[model samples]
Target: MCGITGFVDFTPASEEREVLIDTMTATMHRRGPDDQRTWLDRHVALGVRRLSVVDLVGGVQPMVAQRPGEPPVTLAYTGEVFNCDELRAELRSHGHTFTTSSDTEVVLASYLQWGAACAERLLGMFAFAVWDGRTDEVHLIRDRFGIYPMYYTEVPGGFVFGSALMALLKHPAVEPVVDTEGLRAIVDFVKAPENGIFAGVKEVRGGTIVRFGRNGLSVTTYWAPPARPHEDDLDTTVGTVRELLEDSVRRQLHSDVPLGVFLSGGLDSSALLALAARHNGGETLRTYSIDFAGHDKNFTPDEVRSTPDYPFVARMVEHLGTDHTRVVVSPEELMDPEVRREVLLARDIPTSLGDLDTSYLLLARRFRQDCTVALGGEGADELFGGYHWFLEDRFVDAQALPWLEFGRQMAGKNGLRNTGLINQDLVESLGSDEAERDLYATEVAKIERLPGESDVDRKIRTVTYLNLTGYLRIILDRKDRIGMAVSLEGRVPFLDHRLVEYVYNVPWAMKSFDGREKSLLRAAVRDLLPPSVLYRKKAGYPPIDDPGYDRALRAMVTELLADGSAPIQPFLDLGTAKSYLADPTSAASREKVNRFSLEMVLYLNEWLATYDARLAI
Candidate 1:
């Protein structure tokens, strides 16, 4: 894992380029604290901060490879290539020699052999920039599922790219500006594909390659979930899922540094822990879970999260007999201003998820104390129909994004408004409702329906596609930002493209054969896990429900409203904001609605001030 940034400009002097690249790279020091390196030429400069996961001693960047009489090719890479050994063996047979066992070297060698088509052959989470001195072109590639992040924008003479938005924002050519479209996406939480939420910057779409040369720029999607008929029976499909999942977990276990599993005791995570334990031979695998200081005793069941994770976590720990640690965090920690600032910086954008994002950041920080790489279960829910909304008929039939609709309904039931406290005039001008409808229609049109498919199957397929491409992307981005912020590499075995493709085509009926969430996943590992975990109902990551957290958020909102110079003040609906603040115990201040609204205001305030972001609305 690493943080990579660079620029291709014909104008900057080499010394000036180096200084700029260094500054951009330094912005991601938390991502790669192990080593930092820079490579420069007259027209381009590349920088990387390395975490040293695979080949600690030999994997260094920016790594350059050259053949006699051929232009040298340099790679500033991040994320691991799980199929490195296989690719290495194949490359070696083609007369490629290597001095190191690093996957970084394998990637460069593959690029040398296949040119731009090399991205299609890689099988891991990655976003990298390869400067082919041969053609003076740079190719930026992201994994099929976009488990890692890459952002870029065009410059005067050429372009600039980085592993994170913060890195790109540090470059002099980029500005912290959000246009109407960007603001709409942020406020409505309708993330358009490739929209970076910054005016000029664009996120490299997953499964695509962006090539920049003297001919300007081009993008080609090398991978997508292809529409295909499933011929396998229920038993065969179940067996295939198990095989693919096991292989993915095995490949990801090749890290050189200490690794662990994020165990939520839910089926998805418990399944991963079971597999990792089985593959550990005789060693005791390390597993970690996060909990609030008194959440277990004070736990309140909500519409989404029902049952605390600690009880299930304890069951898994004892069942697996692994070294498990439950990191308890206090509401004070969750409400800390400094911690909130760190979370905002890590995300490089404002979020309304509040403690959900902060808790993960804090967990990742603690995980980094003992592990460099940790396997997580992120894509399983999207792939296997695990969310509560997936089972509800109303959400399944909704024309809008199901999760967004669910959030709206949930908030409405609490006598509160979803997306509350934003300036009503700004929301109307952005046409957020129409924009969401258009976005939904655009995405739905892209789904390739099977010939003669049933109407029910078609609707389910569309919902699955939307969740995989939209909701899953947000989840993966959160996981990457928080984990990388602490220099901890998170590997999602469930997101292996091979697994995603296979399961994507599986009929929904078979996916929920047992009439349960993640039914397929549960059956695939039924024998590996205890029934207590394998049959457990779907539960989300626990939220901080302590009343103290709510008080802190209300206090912050009060302060923001009083401050005359607050940047977010212009965008706030003062009447609505003050109404919620007026009575903390009112229905308007219910934990779910109040936390979300307050979080948006607080996070947006911090982001606007810290990034000097000008709202061009």
Candidate 2:
């Protein structure tokens, strides 16, 4: 809900400390534009940019607790801890006085009460840092799901930390190092590796609490979502799930500022809106939706692009009589060179994926005009077997990346270019960790027991774990970043840890049972949503259909190759680049397997150029 930054140098010069804090906080101005604060102790300095979601009038941060001469503990944070009220009551009973009704004080007080262990007890999507005025140490945390990103590095080529990698880059002392391992993971889109993009800037992995004490830095996993442990009956499971999801959505709706829902006409977001509308009763609930302009008729019978969503979205809004706003982005609009440039700046990285790039910024920009926070249907597919890849044959059978086979198919015919970013053959030859492989196999073994069966089911089940751990994480990460960059808070209700735990082992039969994908989910919320929406097939998020857009992207790629000034040229073959770019359908071609895009390549190149990245992995 805000931007947080700080340094744990025990003895830096006063001038440098002030400048560093100012610069770090400046990079996140978009995140917290309303207010910001900074303070210094003998050994530490803290800075924060405030968006003021929870405490609009008060709750200014970099809030300190110094006792006259004592070096005070200073705290700045980013995120919403949903359990603030309950914790506050307990803290008050223990005699802690609160100066404001903000969750910020709760975070600080919780830390004071339970110390570092406070992170485990609190439930929410967050990343925070606490400076121990007494010990000169810094404590940091990322939520259990990595919903909020935090990156850090040590001085020299290190010693910097930030909420966003770009913020970390603002530190004049920080250097961008190519994480060869991270790049390799991205090349194939290895979604689950807990690390980050920039090499030197290591991300505080999700579900972790890190400490920068005198013994140097250390990390411990405070929590891990209960992986599909054994479960109970469907009736009990669905009943408990409905209540947990309701509770999560209700708590996340906490904000002093205006809020709304990003309702897609599908199961997840639609269900969330339905629930919110039901809770609001006669009150008008503002809702927003995005749709493509000229794509082929999808789930709807009409040959209409953006057709299915309007009908279903209209139905949900009318049923609840909520104030709904629909934002349509034409393929041409997103493909505009200016939009691309603006998106890159907003992302603080050189990202090239068209669809993923579109939704977050567009949604955030438009939604922010009305509301600062919005609810989304992000984490549902991974949790409820919504992706076709989660279907039995798709997940458990002799899986050869069912979801990715399309990409691999593209590679065979499209003539993939060498990025030289990595030696793919060699990297794969090196193989995976025996320990890591064992963990993967262990989870897949459980999937092998699902009642419904198919040849590819076993492989698909293996992929289920991979999806939950890898692909889903990557996409969800993008979902968070794109929205946050625009200063609009995006919350995913389906990511409730309780729901994830129960559904994981509910037996694929229960999830995709009745031959319907996400059957269990549909059963749970069948009443809240209209039949059309409740039964509508998932089309993913809004998609694009502009031949012009692809043409524009291809032309840019070709032009970059023609200019020879692109930082990525050396990593790719001129011939391959020309073929891929000139063909026009390279990105759309399945044969273009493991291939890079102008977007991906541009982002990577810009990331390298922006950070002066040393690509020597």
The estimated TM-scores of all candidates read 0.97, 0.87
Against the hidden true structure, what lDDT does model 1 obtain? 0.87
User: Across residues 1-617, which tens digit of lDDT does each residue of candidate 2 receive?
Assistant: 78888776644455677888888888888888888788876667788888888877768887776567877777888888888999999999988888898888898888888888998777787889998867767888887777877877766412567787777877776655655555555554432344666655567877788788666878887765444344577788777778888888887777788889987788888888877766654568889887666543423331112245677787888877778888877756776666566566565655546554865567678888999888888788877777655654433443443444433333321222223223344345323333334445554554434454444434434565567655666676677667766788878777766666666666665666668877888888888877888888776654454455556656666666666666765665455455555554554433342224455665666656655666655
lDDT top scorer:
1
Which tens-of-lDDT digit does each residue in 573-612 have in candidate 1? 8987887788756765563346677788888889999999
Candidate 2 local distance difference test against the native: 0.68
Pairs with steric clashes in candidate 1:
none
Best by TM-score: 1
RMSD score of candidate 2 (Å): 4.5
Note the clash tally of each candidate.
Answer: 0, 35
| Model 2: CA > 4 A from native | 11-14, 67-70, 156-158, 227-231, 296-308, 397-468, 581-590, 593-596
